[model samples]
Target: MLREKIFYKDELPVSVITANIVDYPFHFHDDMEIVYVLSGSIILKSGYYTYTLKQGDMFILNDRDMHSLERTDEDNMVMMLQMDLSYFERYYPDLRDQFFVVDMEEDKEENLSVLRNIMAEIMMEILQKGQGYEHKVIESTHNLISCLISDFCYVVNEDGKFQNETGGKTSKILAGRLNRIMDYMYENYERKLTLSEIAENEKLSIYYLSHIIKEATGLSFQDLLSYIRVEESERLLLESGKKIGAIAEEMGFSAVRYYIKHFEQWFGMHPLEYRKRYMGKSMTRESRAKYKRCTPMEIETAIHALTRGAFTETEDKLVLKPVIIDIGTAVGDDDNGQPKTAETSAKDPKEAGIFTIMERSVNDILAEPYHLLMDLGETVLAAGENYVITAEGTDTKDISRLSILVYNYDENVGRSLRKIHTENDLLRLVRHYDDEIEFLIRCNGFSGLYRIYRYRMDRENLAKKLTDSLNPEGGAGKRDMLIGRLTGAPTVTTNTYTSSDVLSVRTTFQGMGVELILVDRI
Candidate 1:
């Protein structure tokens, strides 16, 4: 029997398939799909396109595009990622009017290799189910989509200029209407809005407008209006010192109490407190340490006592400390120009001292450290005067226990410069732009979301900066400006091996993944 794949709105909106089958009946799904031939070969058909996919070949199938596996070898292994179209509709509203046109025979071998590697990684993460696997899957999916969009998908603009464009005029009309409605809501969120008024304005039936609004934004008319108003109020609170009651009235709230209630509900704090927290003071090393529930004295004392020879004179060199533990071995070189072994160094307390008695006491007060291998690049020489900064954590899923270790290597002295703890999982050093380096930090939330943190390296220390002010002229500003959150679900580029301006990241909210692109805004 021919089957139809059903997608539930509350689900993850993605499905992974890795199986070998022969002579499957034709079926259709509302979700778009990408099929990659992992090994062996398969013959498949989608709409009018028929092709034989060998190892490393792949193709895309749009929503409701009927396709079937005509043949497969006994050892054939294929992977397919299917995602609901509604998922993209929220971000890329024109997705419905587009169709992917990929010709493996015409594509460059390098492009094929890139796509193959991305799909393979996605399959590995999905099958392995490792920590942050959900995040990995979401990121890979966005990468795949981005690749298709950049290379293959032919999007139909309002003027209609692409071949194989689906939906044509109907898609354009619907998109235009939705965009208009959203624009109107955003422009007039401070005023009272009703479905009937919006419907009459857009010349849409109230019933159809209501349904489409929910389908397009996942929010009803009132809810979306409230969301916009609250967002505007937040901006006003941070940017101005107006009285709360006056601000509420200006934002179209009937009463100050009502605005206060909604503001608290949205931000988990009152407007005055929110304003004070963001607009009041700059976050110094001591204040950040306090925010993480640790003391600057404690971190400084432990590092100073344990490092033996390395020194830190000012708090400007220290960034954050979310975890601290003794690794039991000193991380420097000896006078003989050789790396000192933990066992050998134990013979001489000073030479072998990576941790002193006081440091151990502090470690006991803090937390036990975990041994993690630093993942330097493959091309990095083992023997060189290199200063490497890497991070380690006890658990991959928990960023709160992650520690950043600085290893200073020279012919005579090869030891750890310092170790600082952080509150998030450190993924990778994306790139260095201007005077700052951007790091992808995994948020310790269920949504599997990631945040981009900008840091400035000073000698042997790293100082965190607000993402907005990547190139601050002087002193640090408010704490909230230090990090910038990206929009959309996290995604990577097809050519992962090549350095590009756009970096892919995945962040989840309440078990769902949203892909985001980290760009050098500075």
Candidate 2:
């Protein structure tokens, strides 16, 4: 089959393409793609969702997902770790379950970034072709797959609904064949592809393949091929200075007019406009301007926790209150599997519904930072207009002295601030708005920083404004804020530093003498 050729014989042995990261149309592939973000940020659009990736992030693309890459900011030097699954199978049969094929039934976002830095370095080392390159490559591949499975397999496994559900015969076979066909189309995108050609290659009657293709993907086989061709053509057009007619001809289109029709039909814009909108942003240019390659110093910083005796009982003393916001289909049993109707479970608990929405929003927002806050469990506070702070020790009495405040962002602010675990985390967040507040205050001839702050501190209207300003969409402000606070000098010292520079802060704040108070800051 043409699909088998793409993966088994032709494109699978060794495929390597290192290019600038730019926006491309939706497309699929038969080979496995191992992409490492050398520098900068990228937005990956696949199927119905988009994934935003940062430097030190790498993702595997298989499952023949129709995805594309977009870079909003420059410096996206992405090292693509593409492998023909066939080679993977030959080289390491045991790793088949690890990198065999993306489970088309599941999403690839979760846990894919586990040990990203290590894997990226391995990939970089291979690209550099140092001593024992072959050995290093094999080792790196081993480590990469091991890390992925160990850290992230849980995400795919736990999200049972998204994973392959047991109980499908024809659907599974049809899906698998469709995946095979899509892979073939991507591998031979620049070559001529016809319905009869694919049908014959799949060893299915032309009539059956036609019906199955349409039924499976909701697009005619011919239209799907045209879509794939135009998509690849779009990538080449934007990434290279190829002429429109040349690109059309190269992709097997009958003429430039036919190419234009397909391109316009798929992208809602002409080829030229589409190229202009998506192209011009290159990984080389962006990475050079905004990102510096991981220096030995930064790598050392990431490895600080690994140093012997570098951390002692005195250093892990910070007790942070972490609040888990429950988000999901908690409001009503809307688990994406049922027909919508006026049901009994829908109307009873309005507050519960609100809590569920807030919980979900909070979870989504703090998804990245929760990793750092794993150990510090001071109190699980339910935050809203009223703050409900709870801690398990008899020392909870003094928690009030710490001045705990809950600030909720406004509805229009784009993000929900309800998920932040503690007032200290919020204070660190406030530092990000320092420049913006300073500018607004100075421009308006405000009396003082406090006066300007008072407006933003308004719980109903201004708090959300500040929250939005601090955590803008796709902005790294919150991360910077968290990093700053985490590495900051706290006002009160729970432990004194010794000459050895090792200190531990006792988290006994929630202990016997501790008190808890909830204040509304916004």
Return the top candidate by TM-score: 1
What is the lDDT, from 0 to 100, of the residue 441 in candidate 2? 5
lDDT of 2 by residue, 37-136 (tens): 6556788754444567776555566545455677766656555555555544542354434322233233333333324434444444444545334433
lDDT against the true structure, each candidate: 0.44, 0.42
After TM-score superposition, what is the CA distance of residue 123 in candidate 1 from its true location, in Å?
Answer: 0.7
Number of clashes recorded per candidate: 23, 24
Instruction: Name the 10 consecutive residues with the lowest summed lDDT in model 1.
Output: 311-320
List RMSD in Å for every model shown.
24.6, 23.7
Q: lDDT by residue for model 1 over 371-402, one digit each (tens)?
A: 12123221111111221112233222332222
Residue runs of model 2 more than 4 Å from their true location after superposition: 1-30, 36-40, 55-58, 73-79, 92-114, 127-130, 146-177, 183-222, 228-260, 263-522
Cα-lDDT of candidate 2: 0.42
Give the residue spans of candidate 1 off by over 4 A.
1-3, 6-11, 72-75, 156-502, 508-522
